[model samples]
Target: MTSDKSFFDFISNGLPGPELRKDADNAILPARKLAFSRFRALGLPSVKTEEWRYTNIQRFLKDSFSLAQEEGTISAEQLKLTDIPQLDSYTAVLVNGRLQPALSKLPAEGKVTISKLSDAANNTQLQLWFDKHPHLQQQPFAALNAALFADGLFIEAGVNASLDKPLHIIHIYTTTGNAFIQPRHLMVLHKSATLEIIESSVGLNETAIAFVNSVTEIVLEENAELWHYNLQISEKNSRHIYHTSTVQKADSRYHHFNFTLPSAELTRNNLSVALTGSNTETNLHGLYLATDQQHVDNHTFVDHLVPNCNSNELYKGVLLDNSNGVFTGKIHVHQDAQKTNAFQQNNNLLMSEKASINSQPQLEIYADDVKCSHGFTVGRFSEESLFYLRSRGIGEEAAKTLLVNAFAFDITDQVHIPALQDFLSEKIRKYVSGAINN
Candidate 1:
């Protein structure tokens, strides 16, 4: 365990090491410097920040954390010890913030390339993508992530190729007390390529406070298809901040699934998708379960930059105990984005009187021909349904479980992968049952 230290001092001490990179693109060095400058200018965010008004990060800054290093406390074998059972796939194991290549396995037939970001940073195409979507200036954490990401995942699929198995990437935290990690992941799909990726985060124990800051960027070219899933369940006392951004070309399809368990004390998620071309189809589905004093917040944005794009988003949450949850989703249609079809909905089930959820769903349409609608709902278990279940001789605990499961069914049902759906369903069921038992 480390002593309490200031966050500014920590990041400043760590920012001077990346300028000497040799294998990376010449532009990446300058980009890192720019990102660092942006971070220094932004500094730590206060509640005054509109995007972070509800969450207070002051406490996390006050405590000292073991920032990720090349050396890890655990080995590849240790990564297998996790909450989520392993599924059949090529797995990439990341201990702390560094990629363990010895433990990672790529897909058969060499149809895909999964390697470290440093190894691929010299690629001209990847450099172009990195330069086009450089948005590290948006927030302080994002800037820090850009400047300090230790190692990242790079996946590239050829044109007209489809992967036979999904790629499962797992990130584990093993340092005691508080351990901080910042990782970067980038995926580029050529025209008509298809791929599936799953990112899972886990910690060794509940006593330590693990802090993970990760950024994932994905690009789908014309007619490409992608299914990405993020399943995060850290220590019971941890802080996690994640950002995922996607860009879809014409006739491309992108689907994203996010499942967050209640293990962490504080968690925040940012999901953004840009419809760069017409006839693009985008779908976002998320489910978060929280209990005890946990706090989880999710922010999402969908931009219809072109006309004739369609996006569908649905998020559901079950909050129990004294936990607090926040969801803010925005759907924006540009003035030129006519004939856009977008729908956004957020629903929450407050299982405890003390539990609370703040939901905000926004829709901005500048085009007359756009069909965009956004709404949110927050309520408790239906007493009518409970009564009916009780009348059928079901126990109170069992009745509550059934009602909660029914409320969460819609979100989990949207998961296209059967095994992954079952995995998420079991996690949700455990949380629901725990809330009743506690």
Candidate 2:
């Protein structure tokens, strides 16, 4: 580990000589070089940066960290702790960004292909669409991951293919020392194909800090549909930055659900979708629960490039103790995007006097006939509602839990998976009840 070193300097100077060019594949070297150059030019964001004004990321990077990919193992007992109660699906288990084939039960290889990104370097789709999304061009962290990511998953669904069961991906982070990990992935759905994917994580670092920077790029062809869910509930010693970029074609439907819960010290999510064809439907929903001194930030963008597209976005937050939260949602309609309908809303609840939130919702429209609107709201728990629940014989803790659940109902109700919905509800109740008791 490099002691008292900045993250930028550590990446630029401290890494081993061969670390930068470890991927010797001639076909990918050009892309890697371009991404490395971009990262150098953009550098790291500071407090003065417009997009990162609310979160001071430099504070988290001040500690010592190792660039080397550490080797760690997980037992069956430890792996079971990260499982959802009633999820009956094929599983893919990754530890420190490396896939464990023995621990995973991947889907059959008829029309669906799931393998390691490193092994897919010679694949045609991997060569054509990897790291080519427009939304990832300007993100520094995304560029960094593209240049030096260790290993990740690659999934491709054939045309008109459909999965009978959902796919659950469990990410377990265990490290012997302070480390920085980067995982890069790409998923492509062919025309008229459909799939559902759920991602969750767990951290098992007793005394060391583990920071993860991950990027996942998705592509949906004409008439395709995707149901994507991301659940973040790592330990207190973990920090994360995630970027999910999706491109939608004509008549495609995309539904995304994000739930960020307790214990992680810092979490930042950047989600973006670009509509490239007409008559596409996009839905984005998010719910975040932050306690203690934790910090969570969500930034999203929807680009309407073609006509007859509809997009809707809603994100809610519950902040307790001295936690902080930030939300920024943007919608852009191009001149050719006639008949576009876009709506965005962000709402937050501050349970403690010291808890705070910063929200910004924006819309930019160039088409005169389009319908676009955005809104933001921040408030406390309604005293009247609490009193009514209390008067019905419910104790204070139970009343508060019920109120929080009711507040989160809008986002959770949109989940198509009944088991996942039940798991999220139980998690919310347990966290709220424990916080109130403390």
Candidate 3:
């Protein structure tokens, strides 16, 4: 094993040189520099790192990926929003980490406020929020994002506001060769607010392997209700890594649904929910489909820090061909968290002998009075069901595809938006068709 010094030398001198900020550095630059120094001290996460054991970052380090330069160009019509569902509602478009105002369309009601992160100097409230959330400095990728991120979006819902239309944020990556893009977003829902948000990631160009490291933070105040949906559909040569954190207040309800389908290399997702007030509720659902030589990993943590909090999580995956999948979930009931109810479950379907899956569900209950349970299941398709489908004159391939789709329905059905549901269903069908043809 190489020493920490060796890793530092590798990143600072080896491969492509570290990118320097040429434009005017923001007020956060000094703090971000300190964060970079911290990242240097920590180095890349290896198998020795418990949180990164299943997903490796060594290969990513060796690759010559640099912060994207503002040289690429994309058109509004070329963004391919036509295929996306629920796009007629309020929408924001970002290409290669830069917000495209000309391509974006806002709702007519004007109840919501949207602006670029680069222009946040005038927003004192957002500035205060950033000051309070210095935890972003501890994250290596997030630190890098802070230092290099060019543009992002900030969304706020007024108190007692209810948005009839969902807000969709689209990030499109169209780099030619190997490139890296980091997009940051912060969302705030005030007291008694109700909002729906949809986030989608897409990549074009097959020759270059793109890396998208994104972070999003959501804050829900008292009695706020939020429904969030995330859809990731990158081409065969793209890698995606995401970190999403949520903070909920008293009587708040937050629900999240994530769908990951069709990526070429590796993808990792870290989702954390913190219940900071009493009577908070949270629900999480995820579906991942991997085929060929792809790899998908999900890590989730739920912290019940207050009394009378509730949380439930379900994650399912379908692994076919030589693909690999992993799920690790932990629910922590703090000492002060009395009357907490938490449940977690992970299920996987292996379609080929070479396919692999790893599942770990854990619960740490410091409060004896809390109710928490976790379970996992891993298996292949049911032979009895296959036989029944065959007896009904359905072709073997078609029957298998149908069963795979049915297995995915549990998570896909959770998407309440009609357009999004249709879009996701179509993508799943395409993946199933490809798996059958293979």
Candidate 4:
């Protein structure tokens, strides 16, 4: 059998030509070539890599997978078979990493601007926006994504505009069980603009095997407010590597809500947020559940570049069976960040003897007047709490469910959106019940 290294070889040797960039209007090819070179110079992470010590990603890699080189035909039937239940939000659909414009219903033209990457690439303003963001060459997966992404959603809200409903982005993969794809999304909110974004997925089973490298870039101008939520749930044989890079300006607010549920064979998420302006507030809350042999990892870094930027993070996870999970978070307070306030904590629950977690939370403070603290905990449910539930006539599974639900609430309840919160609650309950039943 071919080894995991073959996957890298396949991607590096298969870079496409200008036809792939025909609609991109030559705006992305240069970036794509640079990223491909970066990937070749610095290969995939190994066990020796400090950031990847906990997860053995090579075991999940394979050379048999094909790249989704062209748009896959999506039937009307496939459009209706979405994993996420319908919600009161604007919808944008992508099939096999290609935008399905006919199936997508965007907001009115003047209120906001939402278009496919190919169409948006022709806009001079969008090109300038891309030129101003941070470099993706530092992260191998991100570089690979940039090299391969053909199309994605580009959303920009005008200054002082407030979206009445959230924007829902649904990504569906279905070329072949053994094909890989990279999806990219870009969002920019002008000054005083407000919006909510929800990302969800679909179309996979245990027999499925695929690789997904995706990235989302965001920019928030002065006084803008953004609420982002991600629901990542995939099949047992699927591997997902996703990244989010965001920049916040002065007086802006950014809130993140994340839920990672069962059955993905491998999952890694990288989140980096830069507080470029003072008086910015950022909050991150997440819940992850892993069972069987699923492996999940979340790494977050917040850079406090200016004074008076406040950032807080709380992540909780439940691991059952032989599943493994990892959490590593860091908050940086620069010399000029005199009034920075940063706090980070990761709490995990191990439900089986073989279940394990590797958690590390770090704080780097250079300013004297900053308040920064970080910590982690890995433990089982409290015996007394479980006993009390059982004493109240609950069965073993029921008691465990009650306790797990309460533990997850510590992070889930912090989501202010009522409908989204309710949906997440039901999803978590179903995942917990499935784990106990298995």
Q: Which candidate is the best by TM-score?
A: 2
**Positional deviation of 45 in candidate 1, in angstroms?**
1.4
Residue-level lDDT of model 2, residues 278-372, one tens digit each, is 99999999999999999999989999999999999999999999999999898999999999999998999889999999998878899999988
Candidates' TM-scores?
Answer: 0.93, 0.96, 0.91, 0.93
Q: What lDDT score is found at residue 277 in candidate 3?
A: 88
Ranking 1 against 3 by lDDT, winner: 1
Give the backbone clash total of model 1: 0
Go through the candidates in order and give each one's C-alpha lDDT. 0.80, 0.89, 0.77, 0.79
| Candidates arranged by TM-score, highest first | 2, 4, 1, 3
Q: Best candidate per lDDT, number?
A: 2
After superposition, candidate 2 runs with Cα above 4 Å error: 1-6, 13-23
Give me the overall lDDT of model 2. Answer: 0.89
* Candidate 2 residue pairs in backbone clash: none
For each predicted model, how many residue pairs clash, with residues at least 3 apart or on different chains?
0, 0, 0, 0
Q: Candidate 1 on 112-179: residue-level lDDT in tens?
A: 88778878878776677763453334867877887777777888898988877888888876666566
* Model 3: lDDT to the true structure: 0.77
Instruction: Itemize residue pairs with steric clashes in candidate 1.
Output: none
lDDT score of residue 271 within candidate 3: 82
Candidate 3's TM-score: 0.91
lDDT of 4 by residue, 1-438 (tens): 134367667786567665665644556677777777777676777777787788776666634777655466666776665534547888888876667768887777775788877678876656666523563546777888877776777888889987778877778766545767787888889999999888876545346576777888889999999999888866566688888888999999999877888767788888889899999999998788999888999988899999999899999999998999999897888899998899998999998899989888867888999888877888987999988988989988778877888899877778766777777777777777788898
Candidates 1 and 2 compared: the better one by TM-score is 2
True-vs-predicted CA distance for residue 181, candidate 4, Å: 0.7
